[model samples]
Every structure is written in C-alpha cells, then in structure tokens.
Target: MRCAVANTTVMVRKYERMSGRQSWSEEEMAKAVAAVVSGKMGYKLAARTYHIPRSTLQRRASKVRYQQPDDPKPLMGHYRRVFTESQEKDLVGYIKSMEKFFMGVSRRDIRELAFQYAEDNNLNHPFDVNTRMAGEDWVRNFLKRNPELLHKSEKDYELEPVNFDQFYHFMCQSS
Candidate 1:
C-alpha cells in the first residue's frame, strides 16, 4: 500500500518507516494489524514495515479487537472551574439580555458578576481574597472558554427610544 513519508509518497508493502513520537492514523494501525493477521507479515516485520511501535502493534495483534470507545475523554485534566457550566450558561443569558437592551457590559462588570455568582453559589473559588472580584486572567480565560460572549459596544445606530422619537418628530416636521 502507498503511505505518506514526509513530504513525498512512498511505495510500501504494509507499513512505512516512521520515527520519533509520530502518531499513527487509525487506518494505518488497522492496515498493520491486517497484514500480521493474514500471515503475510510477522509482528516485528509488520511493525518495522508500518513504522509503528513494536510493543503497541504486539498488544493490538495479541488482543481480540473490539469496537472503539464510545465516550470522549475530557480535555481538562485537573483544572476545576469556579462556576459550574449551568451557572455560566445563566451568565451568558444575562449578558445577552443586557446586550439586547443596548447595554454594553464592561470587563469590570463581568468580573464583579463572576464574583457574585461564586458567592451566591457558595463555591470555593480561587479568586482574590481582598478584592472579591475575579482576576484578569480568569476573565480572559472565561472569554476564551465562552466565545459567544463577545464584548461589543452598543452600536451608534441604536439610539434610545426617547432620542429616536425626538429624531422621528424632527424629521417629519422638516420634510
């Protein structure tokens, strides 16, 4: 089978030669196992041919293969959040509502809100001891985590109802 070798494609029997900590694709691993199972190539030869780790290939070849795991592993290892996901979702809703009313939330307002959320929830957060507000880093990371919470100023076109009424009246009289 043809396999990629660096920038060029090379004609290989079953596996291509690989080095370092390069990750093998699922298809490549399956192909290597297929070669060994069909008695066309031995374990060591298939491993060498496919550029896969000998131990990894041996383990797969020895075991009765099953379907892949259905669940996805968590990206965050030990990192715990100050606020729960539900709380964050609520915060998002609140921010959206405020924006709907043409009220722009500032960074400080977000930090204060986060502090309040944690306090209201009785959560033991790693926030400041004296300031009682969420740290800058926390706010920055929160923005990163919740991309939909994009901070936008109230557009100039969106005037207050009173101002809009006055403008409408002025335009009607002039025209």
Candidate 2:
C-alpha cells in the first residue's frame, strides 16, 4: 500500500499591526495620552510603558489636548456610522410609525429606504449603487444599536412572509 500527501500554499500579508485588533485597552490609551500631555512622560516613553504605538499615542494626545471628543472611548477600529444622528432618529421614527399602522417594514425595505434617503438628500454613503441597498451588516448593526426597536422575542428580525402567513390564516378563519 502507498500513501500520498498534497501541499497547499497560503497567502499572508505584511504586518503593520495588520491584524486589525488593538493591542492596548481604552484605559491604557487614555493614560498614555494623559501621561504624555502632563509632561509626566515623553511620547516614546509613555508608549513603551503602556505597550501602545508611539504615533497613535501622539495623535490621541494631540486630539485630547486640542479638541473635545464626542465619545469618551470609541471603538478600537474607529468604526464610523454612515448616517448622522438625526437621520438615524428619523429612520427609527418612520419604522415605529409604520408599525403602528400595522405595516411593519421588512429588512430589505429599510435598506432600500436608506439608499433612497441618502441619494435624495445628496448625503455621502458607502452603500453599493448597483445593488441600490445598504448591506445586511449595516441593518444588523443598526438594529443592534437601537434596543427599543428589537422584538420582545429573542429574534433580531421578523420574517415578513411568516407574518403575512399568520395574518392570512387569521383572516381565513374569521371568514
């Protein structure tokens, strides 16, 4: 009997901390900036002590010293929202109003609505023009950020077909 083995090649990218994960915690970054700002420690020394990048430490320190941050501790990757606060609020309100009318909007409708709103208002958005809809990931995150909109059940989204089926059944039974 004979056995054979196959070899496969894997691709890897060069690291400039390319893993996309932050090595230091929010508290550590804050302290590093604070130490550098207060003249307690130099940027290089503070970064080394805090196990953070020197350039990041300097940039954060400059921002902290010069400007007011909207959020105290933002996401590590600096994930920014596509829509402004008011726009998101308007979307939530629209969804609520539609639900009150017994016409709950589906996920796809919300995405298309977002695309249309962004286009109509001439606002910059990252949604794909060809698809004419926001990505599913965006809708998922949007719902996640708005806790009140979440269903009482654990399901994050409602199936429109299933809902219609239930409604149809009720109507048929009444007739």
Candidate 3:
C-alpha cells in the first residue's frame, strides 16, 4: 500500500502469534513490589493483580528489600543521560522556538548550547573538559532525532553593477 501523506509505499505483513513473557513497566514493578512489601498481599497475588510475572515481582521485591547503597543511583551501564529527558525536551523546544524568529541554530551552535547547559547544571557529560563542548556525533544524533529542525544556510551574494545601455551603445559603435 502507498501512503499519500508520507509519500512512501507501506508493506503489510501477516500477523503472527507468538507466546512469550511480557515486559513490565517501572510503575507496574514498583506497584507489585510495594503491594508485596505492604504485607497485605502475597507475591503471587500482587503479580496476578498487576498482570505481571510472579517471578519478576518476586525478584523486584527482593531487590527492594536488600537494596545496596549504589543501587539507588541510576544505572549508567551503557549510556549516561547527560541531561534528563525533560531537559532534552526543553532544549529541543528552545531551539525550535528560535526558528520561529527566523533564527536557525547550526550544529556547532547546538553543541555549544548543550555544553553550556551541562556546565550550568553541573551535569556529568561525556564532553571533553578542554573543548567544553558536546561531541559532533551527539549533534548529528540530536538532529536525526529531531527531524523538524531544518538546517537552512543563509547565503551572501556580491552584487556587481552592470550597464546594459553602455554595452548596447559600444556594440553599435563597434559594428
């Protein structure tokens, strides 16, 4: 099928039914663990009520009971959130608002702004200490993520004065 709005062809695939365990959301995990901890409900009962796996709820409840000092901190295993999700959304909003005033931010400008935001917030960013700027890759990924931000380059053209009448007169005289 062709999608007119997107101007692209969409493929329809047959729906396949697969049996697997469903993933639990943060809220669901917390609620299930809390219910089990409250002593009014058992792990199996709470899991059934929350529509989550009993084993998963049991694991979460155990973790909550025996939480270590470092467990409270956010896990920075793969990627560290230099800015929280809300902060990043705000940054994107600010950049987009600038476009409303005919002001376009370049990739470098965004990088600089990101660095300044991190520094001001004292966030532990992955940017270099010497350069004090976010990486080029980060800027590229940011642009990729926000496709609405168009990169428009303002061009400066040099205008040279030309006399068409003088050229016509010179051509007539020469002929």
Give the per-residue lDDT of model 2 (tens digit) for 1-175: 8687678887777646658457789999998998988999999899899999888888999987875443223446856566777778877776665555544657776677678667866876789999899899998898888877776442333533224334333433553
Candidate 3 residue pairs in backbone clash: none
Give each model a TM-score: 0.42, 0.45, 0.45
Question: Model 3 shows how many backbone clashes?
Answer: 0
Which candidate gets the maximum lDDT versus the true structure?
2
Query: In candidate 2, which residue ranges exceed 4 Å CA deviation?
Result: 1-78, 152-175
| Per-residue lDDT of model 1, residues 1-175, tens digit only | 9897688777777986575575777787888998876788998898888888888887887653442233222347875667656768767765565456544556665676677667766877888868878999988888888888765543422343223224323433553
User: What lDDT score goes with residue 36 in model 1?
Assistant: 79
Kindly give the stretch of ten consecutive residues in candidate 1 with the minimal lDDT sum.
156-165
Candidate 3 lDDT tens digits, 6-35: 568878698665766675688988888888
Per-candidate local distance difference test: 0.67, 0.72, 0.67
Model 1 — TM-score against the truth? 0.42
Comparing candidate 2 with candidate 3, which one achieves the higher lDDT?
A: 2
